[model samples]
Target: MFGVLTERQAQQEERLLDEEEKIPPTSIYNLELLRECKSSRRRWKFFCVLVFILTFTSVAQLYLSLSEFKNQLLITTLNRVKSAELTKDIDIIPIHSHNDEWRRLPLYDALRVGAQSVEADVWYFDSDPDTIFVGHNKVFLSSKWNLDDMYLNPLFSLIGQNNIAKRFEDENVSTRRNGIFYNNLHQTLYLYLDIKSNSEKTMAALEDKLSPFINNEYLSYYNSETDEFVEGPVTVIITGNYPYDYIVSKSTRYFFIDAPLFKFKNDEELAKYNHSCIALASSASLYQLTESRRALAGVAGLSEAQVDTISSYIDIAHNNDIKVRIWETPSWPVRTRNEVWKQLITLGVDTLNVDDLYAATTFF
Candidate 1:
């Protein structure tokens, strides 16, 4: 009653209400005050985000340090023993060490797990034909990462040392040696060279680089004239922009071509190329085999229909004694990855293309 708007005051009150109804400018909750509160909240949120990122980065670095230490420890322990006895007891597993060069010790790490196959992404420029660079990318490559030094030298030395065939002979490396794994002498080690740059130049360089292995008769070769496969300590299979025509045209060649798994229609289609020319076939991804969303039932793995589709394709390859490998499989949620691996193995996949060498060896 004491502060009620009078008739004259009512006009002024109504005008002020119309102007300041949404945000009373003169009150405690003024526009400037509200804006200040909002700015404070923004600052607080930014601080929280900054703290989270810092904490996450610190944790990541620590984890990487621990992993590096662990890898080195294992390698050191393995190296303490003689090379001949090192891999003698370890059973060779049907696992392909994808991106072998990425490992802490490159080729040696793959050997530590007794992996049957290893992949090296090679980049050979015409200018540097004799010096083929081995890396996943050009930016990551160093002059020190020559193929002869990292892969060939290590493998050649190991094979030479383990060549029991000429062990008793006065001359060193007089005869073809046993495979890298003493336990599995007959099992051939598949050395997959993924061409990164010009295939012609890369493969041409490889032909010369492989001379030592060829001279030692340590490489598996297919005689086109006799249609015979002579298995040796090492088998080189070229992938990624390989010159299929150049390889097949050879009446006798040390390396074989990796056929596209999806290209072959049936057994008859696959029969055209036997072990002589094509020992293995692969798909870039499982999606290429079947884009069916059914293949991705998430944690449950591929649906029955989708699994059948995969099985059919696998069956075609096996029918002609050709091995099949599918890379870029879903690796997350561990459960799904294991399920897919089990399925592939059950369906008779020749080799499991894996990032984690130890994990794949353990899974099998």
Candidate 2:
């Protein structure tokens, strides 16, 4: 019985020891699960942060792009508005660039289309022996075309077909003359011719050809030799190339002064020489006036002295009932150009030289 009891006790002790040495798997599983949960939370947090940064960056870039687009649109709209306003205010049209196609337009159409002055660069090209033609440039060199064919022929034909308008009269160009064919509108044509290279003989020949036009009673002549400008009958427009002492012993209807202002010694000299002759001055020198007002006088090309020289020229001419005109100015950007125009208007500059027909229409 004792042996049996001892064996039972040993067995119980061994079972107890074994039970103490063994751990529950559920507890270990819970600890490991807790650690994994922590690691998963960390990874989720990192992913969320990365996503947030990417989303924010994307939004920022999108916003910037949209802002830039809006700014560009606004700028475009503003430019368009300014252009429209300028076009509305000015009666002139702006030809984008120099084009010979404008020559085909009727004379009256020129004014209506906003051309301040129709400029014809007259050059005689020798196509063959004894055959000369009026061409704008080297492009139109055929004998079939001449100045007469380019301008006068079309003008005469149009007027001949339409008998309602009267011929050009010297009184006021604004008036509607008979036999003048104005395209739909009653706009008159203003001719600004750049005489091509011609010698004394060629000039004489040109004069003879032009004599028929000159003899018409509807034209006006301004004799630069006499400094007498009248408004009646067609006459050869003369230049102020001679000394100022000469008076228009003969009557003339129109006059042009190519003289520079400084050519005269002083105000009195200018006054004495420019009596009763419509005058024009070069504006090539006035470009720098905007940069510095004090520097206005020193500007090159045509100095203030030259500009001031016109003061007397204008006085003498206007006092004798002649008009004064000026050439050259800031011709682009109607806004900027208008600044110059306003200044000239204040100074009583009659004609504003402009290359764009659209721009001229705006001013007139």
Candidate 3:
């Protein structure tokens, strides 16, 4: 019994020792471990903040780059459109017969060189009353050149053909006829005829003198035989004292008023008077154009103050179906072409009056 009791006590003591070995002792973390854990957390937080900053900065840069590209694209498109607009504007203005000042320039050659519009200064001359020739700047003397030879003949030669006198030449009929009415060949010629002495008497005499060239058929068609000269088809724009009313009434052609009276202070009244007729103004008379608004058909010679005035005129003209032109602005390259061109485009100045259209196209 004593041995058994002692065995039991030994087993009991062994079991207690095993239980104590299995159980872990209460322990506190050291400052180093705690500091290490805190440091690791701080580092993770810093890494996350760095990632956010990098992402935001990258996104911002990309957005800015895209915006800049878009702006550049917009600017380029606007400029291109503006340039095209200018070209179209120039294409529509009357340049053919109006450009007599450039007669020294080969007419056909000038057309080839892009002489889109032209001007003709017509003077009514008479041998009577001391031989006064009515025109701008009375510098010509009767002693200088005969009316028939110097001016009228050259114009008729152009209007007729290489063989205008040969009444039955097919070449004259075809080519010359084409030149009289169609395309740039037959261009819209402005006759700035100054009435020297007696306007009616001079006109009658001049008409008789130009009998061969002045006919409904000649005025109307390239092919005179089959084509009846359509009345109101006269492209010769006569300025000065020519009776436009009588001309249009008698014929089917229309005329543009070259008078400043058309550009009156009360533009509205004048515009309403002749809706069919076009009104012309110098750049100095831009105010008249502005007030008249759509009533005024068109304007010429835009001043510096009239740069912005172009937009206004264009707006009104477009609204009322009118055209606009400018003179003495871009003839000389006082400045760069692009600069002048841009201004013309922005303002909607349809025609740029250049003494040398070829020189003007170079700027384009």
TM-score of each: 0.74, 0.46, 0.47
lDDT-wise, the better of 1 and 3 is 1
Q: Local distance difference test, per candidate? A: 0.80, 0.45, 0.45
**1-364 per-residue lDDT for model 1 (tens digits):** 5466476598898888887776645775576799999999999999999999999999999999999788757655654545677686788888889999888888787887899999999998867657999999899887777798778876787777777557466665434457878787767899999999888878889999999999998899888789887889999999888987778778888988777787667556566565565655554468777874324778877767768887888877777677888877778778888788888888788889899888788776
Best by lDDT: 1
Q: How do the residues 1-364 of candidate 2 rate in per-residue lDDT, one tens digit apiece?
A: 9999999999999998898578588876898999999999999999999999999999999999998687546534433332223223335432211222243342333533545334444444333323335555667556555556555544444433343334545455444223232322332333444445443333444444555455443334566566644443212222322222232333552333334433344566455444544343222123332332222322222234644544555555455444445554554455555665555555565455555555555554
TM-score of 2: 0.46
lDDT of 1 at 343: 81
lDDT of 3 by residue, 295-315 (tens): 122233334654555565555
Model 1 poorest ten-residue lDDT run: 275-284
Reference-based TM-score, model 3: 0.47
lDDT of 2: 0.45
Could you tell me the TM-score of candidate 1? 0.74
Better of 1 and 2 by lDDT: 1
Worst 10 residues of 3 by lDDT: 292-301
Q: Give the Å error, residue 278, model 3.
A: 7.0
